[model samples]
Target chain A: MNSFFQYFADIFNGVKSLLTGMKVTGRYFFSPWEIVTQQYPENRKTLKMYDRFKGEVIMPHTANNEHRCTGCGICETNCPNGSIEIIQDKIDMPDGKKKRIIDKHIYHLSMCTFCGLCIKTCPSDALAWGQEFEHAVFDRTKLTKILNKPGSSILKDISE
Target chain B: MKEVINLPVKNIEEEEYHINMGPQHPSTHGVLRLVVSLQGEIVKSLKPHCGYIHRGIEKMCEKDTYPQIIHLTDRMDYLSAHINNHAVCLLVEKALEVEVPERVKYIRTIVDELNRIASHQLWWCSFGMDMGGLTCFFYGLRDREKILDIFEESFGSRLLHSYYTPGGLMMDIHPDFQKNVKVFIKYFRKKIKDYDDLLSGNVIMQLRTKGVGVISKEDAISFGMTGPTGRGSGFSCDVRKHHPYGVYEKVQFNEIVRTEGDTLARYLNRMDEMRESMNIIEQLIDNIPAGDYTAKMKAVIKLPAGEYFQRVESARGELGVYVVSDGNKTPFRMKFRTPSFSNLSTLDYVSRGCKIADLVAIGASMDYVIPDIDR
Candidate 1:
């Protein structure tokens, strides 16, 4: 007789619990403004990323079209994926002593993992994170960037 | 002529057939294939196939420096990104015998709790979807985004943040980080009730989960399961309680346990765990001491020739990182004893004699990440 009563009580309790669950979802259905999803691409103009957001690596050029990279190759060694390559050429200095100058700082965007090791390890603070992230290209070769701009030179006061 | 047909007497026997579930199916979560042998609807035996996403992270660690390895751990157990990074940081700190600042300790603990909640939230969303309740996915993901926003403002990435370093954090917390976390805590506490109403209280959910896929306490220990999956069996294996690290010892919170050891019990354990995580974060977030975010260290970190191991309680389980240094910048040998691998090994043991449908609930309850197992 006790077990018979317990079975009915269990059914009653289960029904009550299920009803309570329906109440929460029913309330959400009426409140359209509470929906959290944003139309992603449509809101692209108004979308804002955080200030410290890391997008990609960039080397800032001065007004004279010169950068701070000294062809030290620290970033090249620090990169875990071998995404950076330093091409160096010898130039006759004003004092007639041959010195190594950076010919090109090749950055392979396709291979980059954005680990930030290369930028962090730059002793001269030559490299930094850029905010631009829209980096799609038709050709794979277009992604390999020469960070040293054409007709641009390294800073005159190059130090080892 | 009645030629005696060379056929033996016909016999009836129940023959078992096999079915494969995912290397692509949505319910398995990530590329984990299960070969389930069955007699009609009942499962006779089960086998799991892993290693689809193995990227040789441990091998790569041998070539990269200590700081670089922190990035790789972000991929393994990606949901518990902060905790995984913390494990590597702790290993490096111990090898160097460096004492991190009190501020760093407090901040790390608070962030770790927030990380735990986010991971549990994602698991809850997918677990609901696995049970054929699609609405729970939207609700769980909506709340989880708030925590990701806090991480993004401070840590600079949503899914993967290699923020923690050996001596300290990569950068200081954002100025608004405290205010945002406090607001989120207040909001989430109220919604946790709705979570119960929307799914936990539902009769269908209860019927589907309650008293399903039970793992015994002795079996849990033998399988070497840790974290909530083991705790559900009343194993008392909460790593945070047993082995306190960071500022965990200073905090007060219950290590939730359930003796039923069933699917429902494991589900309830994670739900209660999210609340405990909130309690832990509240205790530490307000009292973060003022000190250096990073310590003074050499440009290159070279450890002495020795093998060192450090373990931390991740959202999934206890993650142990072992490093063998040969007095070099990079480790000579690196190994990770991830929790999901052991938890996954017990699946075949528990699923035998149950219906093939029940295996889905059982697998969902274990909450094993595929990459973590393969790694």
Candidate 2:
């Protein structure tokens, strides 16, 4: 008789525990207020990120077809991944003063770890985040971008 | 069929059987090797061997700049990469005396909480698998995927997101991050019941966990366990609550703790902690303060000569970082006091005399991530 009672008591305790757990879960299940969960891609219309959120690096260009980068190569030196490369040229000015110009500012996205070391090390605050995260391409080489515009010289205001 | 007995039999004496437990076993949770001496089915002694996955992260940090070293931290505790990044960033920010914006602090707190939830979810799933319940693994992963989706949408990467930076975050919070997080909390809040019904209340689970791997509060303190491991043993050691870094000071949430330092108590403590993290997230997500995310600092961030130590409550335990700056762009020496290393040390004391099968249960209860241990 004692053994039978023990079995029933054990079953009763098991059921009680299960019911108690279900009650806690049921409370949340019926609640009107839900926590944050946004479906991506489909919810692109409602998707939002920080404006200054660091995603990718880009060079700033002035309206006069000039850029702020002046072949200083500070970013290239600071980059741990060797993602940034700079090529400089000597420009002969009409005023008889030769100026160092950035011929090419190559940024290899493939090798870049996006540590933002390059942007932080820039003496000229000319490099900034472009907010372009969808940079996936068919070929790895396509990720390597040249930041300097063709036939463009350093901005006179920044260089001075 | 009976084989013929050996003609010459020597006098038998007492001998012990030594079994190597890992460096490759699933229950070890990374490349942790344990040498166990057994007397029949009972374990007599156990020795833990480490350093299989050590990548010399301290040496690697010397070669990289302040910003580049953040990536190295991501590899230390992959589950709580954001928190590790936060620790490094806080150290650098302190060295430079840069004050983070209120908005940035709030955003960092939210991301850290989300990462905490994801880490706990993975721990729950992996722990379940270690104990032979495969169903709980799927349930935990299913819930964890929701948190990962939010991270991927806000930050470009899912796991090793080097998002936190010195002055503030790498960028501002995603526009819809608040709303998305709210939805996730609501869904997760409801899903906790399913987890309880499936695993917590199960008779088999209770039998395996409830009274096993018991540790006293005094013993826990002596062993230096933190987070849920310490909390479950009745120690109130939560960095968010104690130190209150970022915006955690503004948020209201209970620090889940249990007096019983048993495997069940630890499991229950984490479950309650997950709920508390959700509670904190619910209150802060909608009311984020508006301000600049990044504080203005010099382009080349050079730290002053000083020693700074910052501690954060990672999902595993207390993750303390000690950094020495020699007024250079990079730290002179960076040392990490990882919780897994200390927590893993307690396993031998707990596992002795227990059945070999119970070793897995004790290990799973400790929540030892081997890479964190090895690093």
Candidate 3:
């Protein structure tokens, strides 16, 4: 008779515990304000990314297309996967000095890990994180970006 | 053959049956294949075959610089990314003998606890889903998103934020980092209580988990299971309390341990850990010292020719990173003792004699990330 009473007590406890659990979920179901899901694509216009976000690397150009890169290749050396290829011209300047200038700073976005190592190691501050993060592409070759614009030359050293 | 000429075998089948449960299955979490042998509804034996998602992380670590290795560690245990990053950073700091600023130490400890809670939130959400509780998936993700937002506002990435670096952090905390964290702590405290009411008290959850996947403390230690899985078996293996690093020595929090050695005990230990993590965060978030985020170091980092190992108490368990430096910018050999690998090894031992449905509860209680096991 005592064992039968214990069995009923166990049943009551289990049912009570289950009902208590249902109460929490039921409360959330009624309170729609607790929902936190963002509808993607529909809310794309309102989406905001933080400033410190590590996006694709880009080289900013002045009005005259003057860039800060000097073909020093510190970023290329710093990259773990060798994603950056710094092509040089080695121009003989008007002052009878052969100086290395960046011809094309090829950045393989496909191979990039977006670790910000290349941007941080650039001595001339040539590279920075671009705000644009939509990187889907059809052609694999499109990922290789040339930092220097067409007909763009390195800014002549005014300090010298 | 003479005895069973007319009728087939009553219990044992003539053919050895085998079924694969992963490498792509939803319940496995990642690409983990479990070769399960079933005798009717009961799981006779289960063998976990890993290495489907292995990207050769340890091999890649050999060619990368000290700072570059942080990016790779994020891929190993993506949920506990911050804790994984912290392990490598701590090892590099110890090998180099670099003194990180007090501010960095305090911020790192707070961020690690935050990451711990977030990892547990994801585990709790998915564990419920694995046990057929669909409502829990939403509730767990809902609370976890708040923590992910805190990560995004500060580290700029939600899942794999390579935030922590050797000697300090990758960058200083955001202007509103402290305020945002404090607000999250207060809000989560109220919501965390609902977890107990929602699932802990649920009869179905109790029936599914209680007294399932029982492992003794000796067995837990022998299997090298750490984290809540070990703690559930009454094995005191919390690395934070044993080997205090960063600002853990300064904070006050209890290491939760359960003696039941059952599935529910492991699940409850993680729930209790979230409370302790919050307590640790609250204690240190107010006292963030104003100083340099990173210490001044040489342009190129080269460790002395020696072996250095550092273990961190991640959300899962003790994540030990071993680096053998040959006085070069890159490490000579790198090995990671991930918690998931050891924790998953105990699956076969505990899952035997349990039903097929109980296997899910046992695996969920272990909380082994497949990629971490593969790595």
Candidate 4:
């Protein structure tokens, strides 16, 4: 007789627990304004990534067509994935000494792991993380980019 | 044709069959295949077949510098990415004898706890969804996003944050980091009650989990289970409590343990662990010191010739990093004693004789991340 009563008690407890759980979902059901999801594609116009987002490596070129990189190739050596390639050419300086100048700073987006090592270890603050994250391209060759603007030269007082 | 063709008699109870659970099943959660042998609906034995997602991270570590290895560690156990980075950082720091700033220690500890909460939140939701309750999936992710936002503002990546370098953090905490963390703590404290009401007290959840996947305390220790899985069996193996790396030594919190040694106990252990993590964060958030984020170190980090081991309590379990340095820029041989592989070994032991349907629940309760296992 006692076991029979206990069986019914267990069922009652189960149903009560189910009701309590439903109360949580029910509260959210009535309040439709409490939704937390942001429609991704629809909200793209208003979307802004955080300032510190490690999107991609970019060499900032000034309006005067000058960059900070001195062709030291520190970033090239520090990059774990061999994504950065620094080609150098010797130029006759005003002091009659041949100084190495950067011909092209090539960056391969496909090979870059976004680890920020190249940016952090750059000696002259040459590399910075760009805010642009949409790197998808239909062709693979498009990912290999020359970071320095066309015909850009080194900054005058930039330290190596 | 009555030619003495005698057929062997089949035993009624000896029927056993095998089925592959997944390399792609959602319940397995990340490309883990289990070969389950069954007699009727009862699981006779279980075998986990890993290496579907192995990336050879340990091999990659040999070629990379110590600072570069932090990124590789993040890829292993991506849920507890911060703690994984912390393990490698601590290993290098101990070997180099670099005393990181107090600020760095406080920030690392707080971020570690936040990562713990996020991991446990994901685990709880996934565990709940695996057990047929879908609401937990929404609630858990809803809260987890807040922590990710904090991470993004400070560390620049939502997941796979290589924030900790060898000697100290890669950068100082963002100006709003403390304020944002406090807001999250206050907000989550209220929501955790809802977690209990929605799932903890639910009789159906208890019925499915209680007394399932029972592992003895001795068996748990023998199997080398750590973190919440071992804590569920009352095998007090929290590396934070025992070893106390970072600023964990200064913090006050209880190491939650349960003696039930079952699926429900493991489930509850993580649930309580989330609360304990909050307690840890609340204790340290207001008292962070003003100092340098990193220590003064050379441009290149090369540990002296020796072997160094450092362990930290990750969201899953104890993540130990072993580095053998022969006085080089990179490690001679790097070994990671990840927790998931050991925890997965016990699945076959605990799930034997359980219904095959319960195997999903058992596996979920263990919370073994597969990439950590393969790595």
Q: What is the C-alpha RMSD of each candidate to the true structure, in Å?
A: 3.0, 5.4, 3.1, 2.6
Q: In terms of docking quality, how is candidate 1 classified? A: medium
Question: What is the CA-based DockQ of model 3?
Answer: 0.70
- iRMSD of all candidate structures: 1.5, 4.8, 1.4, 1.0
Compose the digit string of candidate 4's lDDT tens values, residues B193-233: 98998999999889989999999999999999999999999
Residues B115-218 of candidate 2 have per-residue lDDT tens digits of: 99999898889888987877667678878988877787777567888888778777666777888888889888888878887678877678888878888888
- The window of 10 residues in a row where model 2 chain B has the poorest summed lDDT is B8-17
What candidate 4 gets wrong by more than 4 Å, as runs, is: B1-14
Top candidate (lDDT): 4
- Sorting all predicted structures by DockQ, with the top scorer first, yields 4, 3, 1, 2
Question: Candidate 3, A62: how far from true, in Å?
Answer: 3.6
The digit string of per-residue lDDT tens for model 4 on A7-112 reads: 9999999999999999999999999998999998899899999989888899998989999998888888888889999899998878898888899999999998
**DockQ, all candidates in order:** 0.67, 0.20, 0.70, 0.80
* CAPRI quality of model 4: medium
Model 2 bad stretches (over 4 Å)? A1-4, A11-71, A87-112, A119-160, B1-14
Q: Sort all candidates by TM-score, best to worst.
A: 4, 3, 1, 2
Q: Write the per-residue lDDT of candidate 3 for residues B1-375, one digit (tens) a residue.
A: 557457554655534467898878777887889999987767889988887888999999999999899889998999999999999999988888999999999988999999999999999998889988888888888888888888887887788888887888777899988899889999999998888888887888898898999999999999999998899999999999999999898888999999999999999999999999999999998899999999877788999999889999988998999988899999999999999999998999999989888987888888988779988
Residues B158-234 of candidate 1: C-alpha lDDT, one tens digit per residue: 88888888899888999999999999999999999988887888778888888888899999999988888999999
- Docking quality category of candidate 2 according to DockQ thresholds: incorrect
Could you tell me every candidate's TM-score relative to the true structure?
Answer: 0.94, 0.81, 0.94, 0.96
Off by over 4 Å in 3: A153-160, B1-16
- Kindly give the number of clashing pairs for every candidate: 0, 17, 0, 0
lDDT (C-alpha) at residue B115 in model 2: 95
